[model samples]
Target: MTIREITDLVQGEVLCGEERAGDEVACVFASDLMSDVLTLKDVDNLMLLTGLCNLQSVRTCEMSDINYMLVVRGKEVTEDMLELAEDNDMVIVRTKYSMFKTSGILYAAGLPPVY
Candidate 1:
Protein backbone atom coordinates (compact mmCIF):
# COMPACT_ATOMS: atom_id res chain seq x y z
CA MET A 1 0.00 0.00 0.00
CA THR A 2 1.00 3.57 -0.56
CA ILE A 3 1.53 5.86 2.40
CA ARG A 4 -1.39 7.99 1.23
CA GLU A 5 -3.67 4.95 1.19
CA ILE A 6 -2.47 3.80 4.57
CA THR A 7 -3.06 7.26 5.98
CA ASP A 8 -6.62 7.22 4.68
CA LEU A 9 -7.28 3.71 5.98
CA VAL A 10 -6.09 4.60 9.47
CA GLN A 11 -7.54 8.12 9.48
CA GLY A 12 -4.10 9.55 10.05
CA GLU A 13 -2.47 12.96 10.03
CA VAL A 14 0.84 13.19 8.21
CA LEU A 15 3.39 14.94 10.41
CA CYS A 16 5.96 15.12 7.64
CA GLY A 17 7.16 13.73 4.30
CA GLU A 18 3.96 14.43 2.45
CA GLU A 19 6.13 14.39 -0.64
CA ARG A 20 6.55 10.66 -0.17
CA ALA A 21 2.89 9.91 0.29
CA GLY A 22 2.87 7.77 -2.84
CA ASP A 23 5.62 5.55 -1.55
CA GLU A 24 4.88 1.84 -1.50
CA VAL A 25 4.82 -0.17 1.73
CA ALA A 26 4.83 -3.92 1.23
CA CYS A 27 4.80 -5.08 4.86
CA VAL A 28 4.52 -3.89 8.44
CA PHE A 29 6.42 -4.32 11.69
CA ALA A 30 4.46 -3.16 14.71
CA SER A 31 6.31 -2.90 18.02
CA ASP A 32 7.10 -0.59 20.89
CA LEU A 33 10.37 -2.44 21.53
CA MET A 34 13.36 -0.90 19.83
CA SER A 35 15.30 -4.12 20.39
CA ASP A 36 12.71 -6.07 18.46
CA VAL A 37 12.80 -3.41 15.78
CA LEU A 38 16.54 -3.94 15.36
CA THR A 39 15.88 -7.62 14.65
CA LEU A 40 14.22 -6.73 11.38
CA LYS A 41 16.45 -7.44 8.39
CA ASP A 42 14.03 -6.61 5.59
CA VAL A 43 13.55 -2.90 6.14
CA ASP A 44 12.86 -1.85 2.57
CA ASN A 45 9.28 -0.79 1.97
CA LEU A 46 8.34 -1.78 5.50
CA MET A 47 6.21 0.43 7.70
CA LEU A 48 6.87 0.64 11.44
CA LEU A 49 3.64 0.84 13.39
CA THR A 50 4.08 1.72 17.03
CA GLY A 51 2.94 4.06 19.78
CA LEU A 52 6.45 5.30 20.48
CA CYS A 53 6.41 8.85 19.22
CA ASN A 54 9.86 9.68 20.46
CA LEU A 55 13.44 10.12 19.38
CA GLN A 56 14.29 6.51 20.18
CA SER A 57 11.81 5.19 17.63
CA VAL A 58 12.96 7.72 15.04
CA ARG A 59 16.58 6.79 15.58
CA THR A 60 15.75 3.11 15.39
CA CYS A 61 14.12 3.58 12.02
CA GLU A 62 17.06 5.59 10.76
CA MET A 63 19.52 2.89 11.74
CA SER A 64 17.28 0.15 10.38
CA ASP A 65 16.65 1.98 7.06
CA ILE A 66 12.91 1.86 7.68
CA ASN A 67 11.40 5.00 6.15
CA TYR A 68 7.78 4.82 7.19
CA MET A 69 6.10 5.12 10.60
CA LEU A 70 2.50 5.08 11.82
CA VAL A 71 2.04 6.23 15.37
CA VAL A 72 -1.04 4.93 17.18
CA ARG A 73 -3.25 6.34 19.96
CA GLY A 74 -2.74 9.86 18.70
CA LYS A 75 0.47 10.35 20.66
CA GLU A 76 2.02 13.76 20.25
CA VAL A 77 5.19 13.63 18.14
CA THR A 78 8.11 15.61 19.43
CA GLU A 79 9.56 18.32 17.20
CA ASP A 80 12.96 16.71 17.49
CA MET A 81 11.61 13.49 16.09
CA LEU A 82 9.79 15.32 13.32
CA GLU A 83 12.90 17.27 12.32
CA LEU A 84 14.99 14.12 12.26
CA ALA A 85 12.44 12.23 10.19
CA GLU A 86 12.01 15.08 7.75
CA ASP A 87 15.75 15.41 7.36
CA ASN A 88 16.01 11.70 6.64
CA ASP A 89 12.96 11.79 4.34
CA MET A 90 10.97 9.42 6.50
CA VAL A 91 7.19 9.57 6.47
CA ILE A 92 5.36 9.74 9.81
CA VAL A 93 1.61 9.44 10.26
CA ARG A 94 -0.39 9.78 13.47
CA THR A 95 -3.74 8.17 14.14
CA LYS A 96 -6.30 8.24 16.95
CA TYR A 97 -6.78 4.48 16.66
CA SER A 98 -5.05 2.06 18.99
CA MET A 99 -2.19 -0.02 17.70
CA PHE A 100 -4.37 -3.11 17.47
CA LYS A 101 -7.02 -1.47 15.35
CA THR A 102 -4.49 0.23 13.13
CA SER A 103 -2.67 -3.05 12.62
CA GLY A 104 -5.88 -4.83 11.75
CA ILE A 105 -6.85 -2.20 9.25
CA LEU A 106 -3.49 -2.37 7.50
CA TYR A 107 -3.45 -6.17 7.52
CA ALA A 108 -6.94 -6.35 6.12
CA ALA A 109 -5.86 -3.94 3.44
CA GLY A 110 -3.33 -6.61 2.33
CA LEU A 111 -0.23 -5.37 4.10
CA PRO A 112 1.40 -8.49 5.52
CA PRO A 113 3.33 -8.95 8.74
CA VAL A 114 7.09 -8.73 8.54
CA TYR A 115 7.73 -12.18 9.92
Candidate 2:
Protein backbone atom coordinates (compact mmCIF):
# COMPACT_ATOMS: atom_id res chain seq x y z
CA MET A 1 0.00 0.00 0.00
CA THR A 2 1.08 3.54 -0.50
CA ILE A 3 1.85 5.88 2.39
CA ARG A 4 -1.15 7.97 1.34
CA GLU A 5 -3.36 4.90 1.67
CA ILE A 6 -1.96 4.19 5.12
CA THR A 7 -2.51 7.74 6.27
CA ASP A 8 -6.06 7.64 4.95
CA LEU A 9 -6.76 4.26 6.53
CA VAL A 10 -5.36 5.04 9.95
CA GLN A 11 -6.29 8.71 10.04
CA GLY A 12 -2.79 9.36 11.38
CA GLU A 13 -1.28 12.79 11.59
CA VAL A 14 1.63 13.40 9.27
CA LEU A 15 4.20 15.01 11.49
CA CYS A 16 6.75 15.36 8.72
CA GLY A 17 7.85 14.13 5.31
CA GLU A 18 4.64 15.17 3.66
CA GLU A 19 6.34 14.97 0.32
CA ARG A 20 6.85 11.25 0.84
CA ALA A 21 3.18 10.39 1.21
CA GLY A 22 3.21 8.89 -2.24
CA ASP A 23 5.81 6.34 -1.27
CA GLU A 24 4.79 2.69 -1.31
CA VAL A 25 4.82 0.44 1.74
CA ALA A 26 4.64 -3.28 1.12
CA CYS A 27 4.51 -4.42 4.76
CA VAL A 28 4.32 -3.35 8.38
CA PHE A 29 6.26 -4.18 11.56
CA ALA A 30 5.26 -3.30 15.08
CA SER A 31 7.93 -3.21 17.75
CA ASP A 32 9.12 -1.20 20.71
CA LEU A 33 12.57 -2.68 21.01
CA MET A 34 15.12 -1.03 18.79
CA SER A 35 17.49 -3.97 19.29
CA ASP A 36 14.92 -6.41 17.93
CA VAL A 37 14.33 -4.27 14.86
CA LEU A 38 18.06 -3.89 14.29
CA THR A 39 18.47 -7.66 14.30
CA LEU A 40 16.06 -8.09 11.42
CA LYS A 41 17.69 -8.30 7.99
CA ASP A 42 14.82 -7.97 5.50
CA VAL A 43 12.82 -4.96 6.50
CA ASP A 44 12.96 -2.81 3.39
CA ASN A 45 9.82 -0.97 2.23
CA LEU A 46 8.06 -1.62 5.53
CA MET A 47 6.22 0.73 7.82
CA LEU A 48 7.28 0.61 11.47
CA LEU A 49 4.62 1.07 14.12
CA THR A 50 5.94 1.54 17.64
CA GLY A 51 5.12 3.13 20.94
CA LEU A 52 8.75 3.74 21.77
CA CYS A 53 9.09 7.49 21.84
CA ASN A 54 12.82 7.83 21.43
CA LEU A 55 15.45 8.77 18.89
CA GLN A 56 16.58 5.15 18.88
CA SER A 57 13.36 4.20 17.14
CA VAL A 58 14.24 6.58 14.33
CA ARG A 59 17.72 5.11 14.19
CA THR A 60 16.33 1.61 13.96
CA CYS A 61 14.00 2.67 11.15
CA GLU A 62 16.91 4.19 9.29
CA MET A 63 19.12 1.14 9.69
CA SER A 64 16.29 -1.22 8.77
CA ASP A 65 15.61 0.82 5.61
CA ILE A 66 12.04 1.35 6.67
CA ASN A 67 10.29 4.09 4.74
CA TYR A 68 7.71 4.98 7.29
CA MET A 69 7.60 5.34 11.09
CA LEU A 70 4.23 5.46 12.80
CA VAL A 71 4.23 6.39 16.45
CA VAL A 72 1.20 4.90 18.22
CA ARG A 73 -0.43 5.14 21.68
CA GLY A 74 -0.50 8.91 21.66
CA LYS A 75 3.22 9.08 22.24
CA GLU A 76 4.88 12.33 21.28
CA VAL A 77 8.08 12.21 19.28
CA THR A 78 10.97 14.42 20.33
CA GLU A 79 12.59 16.99 18.07
CA ASP A 80 15.72 14.86 17.93
CA MET A 81 13.70 11.93 16.67
CA LEU A 82 12.11 14.13 14.01
CA GLU A 83 15.53 15.37 12.97
CA LEU A 84 16.81 11.82 12.78
CA ALA A 85 13.88 10.79 10.63
CA GLU A 86 14.37 13.81 8.38
CA ASP A 87 18.06 13.04 8.04
CA ASN A 88 17.21 9.44 7.17
CA ASP A 89 14.59 10.56 4.62
CA MET A 90 11.79 8.70 6.34
CA VAL A 91 8.21 9.73 6.87
CA ILE A 92 6.97 10.21 10.46
CA VAL A 93 3.37 9.93 11.56
CA ARG A 94 1.56 10.00 14.90
CA THR A 95 -1.59 8.19 15.95
CA LYS A 96 -3.69 8.19 19.05
CA TYR A 97 -4.53 4.51 18.74
CA SER A 98 -2.76 1.81 20.70
CA MET A 99 -0.05 -0.26 19.09
CA PHE A 100 -2.26 -3.35 18.76
CA LYS A 101 -5.13 -1.36 17.37
CA THR A 102 -2.95 0.43 14.90
CA SER A 103 -1.38 -2.79 13.73
CA GLY A 104 -4.77 -4.41 13.40
CA ILE A 105 -6.08 -1.55 11.33
CA LEU A 106 -3.17 -1.71 8.95
CA TYR A 107 -3.35 -5.49 8.73
CA ALA A 108 -7.03 -5.41 7.99
CA ALA A 109 -6.27 -2.94 5.25
CA GLY A 110 -3.98 -5.55 3.62
CA LEU A 111 -0.63 -4.55 5.03
CA PRO A 112 1.16 -7.84 5.55
CA PRO A 113 3.46 -8.60 8.46
CA VAL A 114 7.13 -8.06 7.78
CA TYR A 115 8.10 -11.37 9.30
Candidate 3:
Protein backbone atom coordinates (compact mmCIF):
# COMPACT_ATOMS: atom_id res chain seq x y z
CA MET A 1 0.00 0.00 0.00
CA THR A 2 0.99 3.60 -0.47
CA ILE A 3 1.75 5.93 2.43
CA ARG A 4 -1.11 8.16 1.32
CA GLU A 5 -3.54 5.22 1.47
CA ILE A 6 -2.24 4.11 4.84
CA THR A 7 -2.60 7.65 6.19
CA ASP A 8 -6.21 7.74 5.10
CA LEU A 9 -6.97 4.25 6.42
CA VAL A 10 -5.49 5.05 9.82
CA GLN A 11 -6.79 8.60 9.99
CA GLY A 12 -3.25 9.81 10.46
CA GLU A 13 -1.61 13.21 10.43
CA VAL A 14 1.68 13.57 8.63
CA LEU A 15 4.34 14.83 11.03
CA CYS A 16 7.12 14.73 8.45
CA GLY A 17 8.18 13.63 4.97
CA GLU A 18 5.10 14.76 3.13
CA GLU A 19 7.06 14.27 -0.09
CA ARG A 20 7.23 10.58 0.72
CA ALA A 21 3.49 10.14 0.82
CA GLY A 22 3.61 8.26 -2.47
CA ASP A 23 6.06 5.68 -1.22
CA GLU A 24 4.91 2.09 -1.29
CA VAL A 25 4.95 -0.11 1.80
CA ALA A 26 5.32 -3.87 1.44
CA CYS A 27 4.21 -4.73 4.96
CA VAL A 28 3.53 -3.51 8.50
CA PHE A 29 5.44 -4.10 11.75
CA ALA A 30 3.65 -2.94 14.88
CA SER A 31 5.67 -2.95 18.07
CA ASP A 32 6.77 -0.64 20.86
CA LEU A 33 9.92 -2.68 21.66
CA MET A 34 13.02 -1.27 20.07
CA SER A 35 14.74 -4.63 20.53
CA ASP A 36 12.06 -6.35 18.51
CA VAL A 37 12.44 -3.71 15.84
CA LEU A 38 16.19 -4.31 15.72
CA THR A 39 15.70 -7.93 14.75
CA LEU A 40 14.35 -6.91 11.38
CA LYS A 41 17.05 -6.49 8.73
CA ASP A 42 17.11 -5.83 4.98
CA VAL A 43 13.33 -5.93 4.81
CA ASP A 44 12.46 -3.18 2.39
CA ASN A 45 9.42 -0.93 2.30
CA LEU A 46 8.36 -1.60 5.89
CA MET A 47 5.99 0.62 7.85
CA LEU A 48 6.26 0.66 11.64
CA LEU A 49 3.28 1.27 13.89
CA THR A 50 4.18 1.86 17.48
CA GLY A 51 2.94 3.60 20.61
CA LEU A 52 6.45 4.41 21.76
CA CYS A 53 6.83 8.11 21.10
CA ASN A 54 10.56 8.65 21.52
CA LEU A 55 13.78 9.35 19.68
CA GLN A 56 14.87 5.74 19.97
CA SER A 57 11.85 4.75 17.94
CA VAL A 58 12.96 7.14 15.21
CA ARG A 59 16.49 5.79 15.41
CA THR A 60 15.17 2.28 15.21
CA CYS A 61 13.24 3.13 12.09
CA GLU A 62 16.32 4.65 10.49
CA MET A 63 18.40 1.57 11.24
CA SER A 64 15.66 -0.77 10.11
CA ASP A 65 15.20 1.09 6.81
CA ILE A 66 11.58 1.71 7.60
CA ASN A 67 10.38 4.58 5.45
CA TYR A 68 7.12 5.14 7.25
CA MET A 69 6.04 5.14 10.91
CA LEU A 70 2.46 5.34 12.16
CA VAL A 71 2.20 6.34 15.80
CA VAL A 72 -0.88 4.96 17.51
CA ARG A 73 -3.17 5.91 20.42
CA GLY A 74 -2.87 9.63 19.88
CA LYS A 75 0.57 9.87 21.45
CA GLU A 76 2.35 13.20 21.50
CA VAL A 77 5.27 13.47 19.08
CA THR A 78 7.95 15.83 20.33
CA GLU A 79 9.75 18.29 18.09
CA ASP A 80 13.03 16.48 18.68
CA MET A 81 11.50 13.25 17.40
CA LEU A 82 10.13 15.06 14.37
CA GLU A 83 13.51 16.66 13.65
CA LEU A 84 15.29 13.35 13.91
CA ALA A 85 12.80 11.67 11.60
CA GLU A 86 13.16 14.52 9.14
CA ASP A 87 16.92 14.17 9.26
CA ASN A 88 16.53 10.52 8.32
CA ASP A 89 13.89 11.39 5.73
CA MET A 90 11.42 9.07 7.42
CA VAL A 91 7.73 9.72 7.16
CA ILE A 92 5.87 9.89 10.49
CA VAL A 93 2.11 9.68 10.81
CA ARG A 94 0.13 10.21 14.00
CA THR A 95 -3.13 8.34 14.44
CA LYS A 96 -5.88 8.57 17.04
CA TYR A 97 -6.57 4.83 17.03
CA SER A 98 -5.11 2.32 19.45
CA MET A 99 -2.23 0.17 18.23
CA PHE A 100 -4.52 -2.80 17.78
CA LYS A 101 -7.17 -0.80 15.98
CA THR A 102 -4.60 0.83 13.75
CA SER A 103 -3.14 -2.53 12.83
CA GLY A 104 -6.56 -3.95 12.14
CA ILE A 105 -7.47 -1.10 9.88
CA LEU A 106 -4.27 -1.48 7.88
CA TYR A 107 -4.68 -5.24 7.72
CA ALA A 108 -8.26 -4.93 6.57
CA ALA A 109 -7.08 -2.52 3.95
CA GLY A 110 -4.74 -5.21 2.50
CA LEU A 111 -1.53 -4.42 4.31
CA PRO A 112 0.18 -7.68 5.19
CA PRO A 113 1.98 -8.24 8.48
CA VAL A 114 5.75 -8.68 8.53
CA TYR A 115 5.39 -12.05 10.25
Q: How many residue pairs clash in each candidate at the backbone level?
A: 0, 0, 0
Q: Which scores higher on TM-score, 1 or 2? A: 1
Candidate closer to the true structure by lDDT (higher is better), 1 or 2:
1
Ranking by TM-score: 1, 3, 2
lDDT of 1 by residue, 9-44 (tens): 999988999999999999999999999999998888
Q: Give the Cα lDDT of each candidate.
A: 0.94, 0.85, 0.90
Q: State the weakest 10-residue window (summed lDDT) of model 3.
A: 40-49
Tens-digit lDDT string for candidate 2 (1-115): 8887888777888888999999889888798988888877787787888999897788878777886888987788888888888988889988888888888899998889967
RMSD of each: 0.6, 1.1, 0.9
Candidate 3 contains a number of clashing pairs equal to 0
Arranged by lDDT with the best first, the candidates are 1, 3, 2
> Clashes in model 1: which pairs?
none
- Candidate 3 wrongly placed segments (more than 4 Å): none
Best by lDDT: 1
